[model samples]
Target: MSTRQEEATWTTLETFDVEVSSPSNRLYRNGRQQVEVTVKLRARNEDGRIVPLSEEQKRSVRLIDYNSGEVLPDIPASGTVATGWGTTSVRNEYEFFPGARDGMPGQIGPAEGYTFVVRYVQTVDAAPKRIGAQVRRDAQTVFKTNADNVQKSIEAVPERLPSFDERATSVEHGWESQRVVGDENDWDLRTVDYYFCGLSINGNRVKLREFTVRPASMFQWESTNPASEIFSFTGFGTPGSSMAQYNVPAAFSDRRHNPISMPSDGRGIVVLIRSNGIAQSSAGNVHKGACDVDARDEFGTDHPLRVSFKSSSNRNELVLTRR
Candidate 1:
């Protein structure tokens, strides 16, 4: 038997507010107003009116503040299906406020006003979709992690790591997040990381090399920056590759679960690494990376500090050996 093929149809959905948020009338910028809006997506039908969306259209959506143009965290796609082309309404609730100033205090917003937009992204092969919305701001200012899953007890890292010229005897690991004002004028590319291992002594993983990029802004306007800085800093360990990689320490990997000797004075060496920003922080409280390894001897006593920064870079190398 022969099967018949049918033409496939595609449609674009229109986004609108459900009118289920603060401000009985519209958005205003007197102060920061908490807006709770549920954006709905639907396609056009034969009647030229809005109708339910097709199940084939898988969508991943996020929100952007109208006034400040601050992008919010992505709300993962929901209501995905393989069939039922058009039978259900697909939408998500977004909780955000308008009138946020970049460097202003949390109590105030910007003195400017502009239109807000709701953005949509579909999984199917197509460009991202967006809709314009009104944001009522009176030119005032607006503004503003799950741990415990980690098996490691995170500690503070020293501002400095052991120099490559020192003997290989101790080991440690740590990282930090830098803070900065974020906007179109902010830094985009974060530094690529590099780690190199040259000389070795008695199975010692102390000899270290490193590569680093410029730090990211600690105060992230949205959850992330649109810039390509940190997004471009991605790579994995290539086992025997002689180039820069992330998380793959040349000799540092051997230090895990291993302990070094404690000095008679009880002070040991500290190694540290810094992590880029996650683009989420308050003025005084941004993301920070720090760790101090408690290198224990046979006695299990936590005294000396050993630090190491697990950094990833594709274009830089940190030499742990003497010049």
Candidate 2:
């Protein structure tokens, strides 16, 4: 909140007049900010000397909600303090918050002007008899400006599983798991981003990109355990050299995982890949992957697909082969 002193209004009564002012005239449309309205009670004796309300007068003073037309009490404030000459006063405070009328994040339109008012009155009444006086009042026009108001802050990072385990001594070199119908909910991919973490096969880190974190669907449930696919990478930085690895979140043998797919956009998601508020890392490596796991188009066959050379036909066609 940019706490700037704003102009307020004043209402004078017989003995004491209420001084009203706000800490700000501009606020955010999010309605999270509260404008502090300070109310100070001032008194003047017949000798033209400023004085304080008596103990009885202090207790007698009341507060009213001018906006809702209702009387209020015990409004939080800087409790009464002695100024000088035994003349002291209490400073009462109130807040006026503004918000979006549409109630949605992008629904609310451009900047809008608004007016919120609050008033107070001192009153003492007895059965069938009443005496009321104004203590303090505020009727100021405040604006709900565009949201360049509040300070920017980073909340927290999204939770995700780590890419490596410290206890594991060696990589398991084996082809163990079978391809079976997997649970539609098991999207084992890098959902959160790893900044500057050298998880890339090329010794460089890549951003995972943020997306919508959605819950896996139960309707597509097929099995508790899903099958995993194995992929091998070959021919990079070596003369006629090659390497292969299966794309599995667990050990190379822990292949009981269902394949899941999620849209790059936020609309519909399949029982595959967890879009944990971010685009997950590609199946094999962040950049490189087995060509067999993902299909390709002529020249646009992502650079990773080039590593495997699964199909050399420069045609934008789909072929199905059942082994």
Q: How do the residues 1-323 of candidate 2 rate in per-residue lDDT, one tens digit apiece? A: 11111112212222222222333222222112222222334433355433443333334434333223233443233322112001112323312212222211122111221111233221121111111123332234111111221231211111111111122233221111111233434324322111010012123222212111111111111121223232221111111112112233322223222222112221111111112221132232232322221211111111111112124321111121211
Global local distance difference test of model 1? 0.24
Question: What C-alpha lDDT do the candidate models reach, one value each?
Answer: 0.24, 0.22
- The candidate maximizing lDDT is 1
RMSD of 1: 26.5
Q: Top TM-score: which candidate number?
A: 2
Query: Cα lDDT for residue 60, model 1?
Result: 28
lDDT of 1 by residue, 1-323 (tens): 11111101212233323222222212212111123333333334345543333222222223333333344333233422222111122232321222242332122111221112223211221121121122211123111100221232211110111122133244332222222213323334332232222222335322222222212111112224343222222222221323322332233233121121211122222212222333222223332232222232211112233122233332111212111
Which portions of model 1 show Cα errors greater than 4 Å? 1-15, 18-34, 45-51, 55-59, 67-71, 74-323
- Give me candidate 1's TM-score against the actual structure: 0.17
Score every model by TM-score: 0.17, 0.23
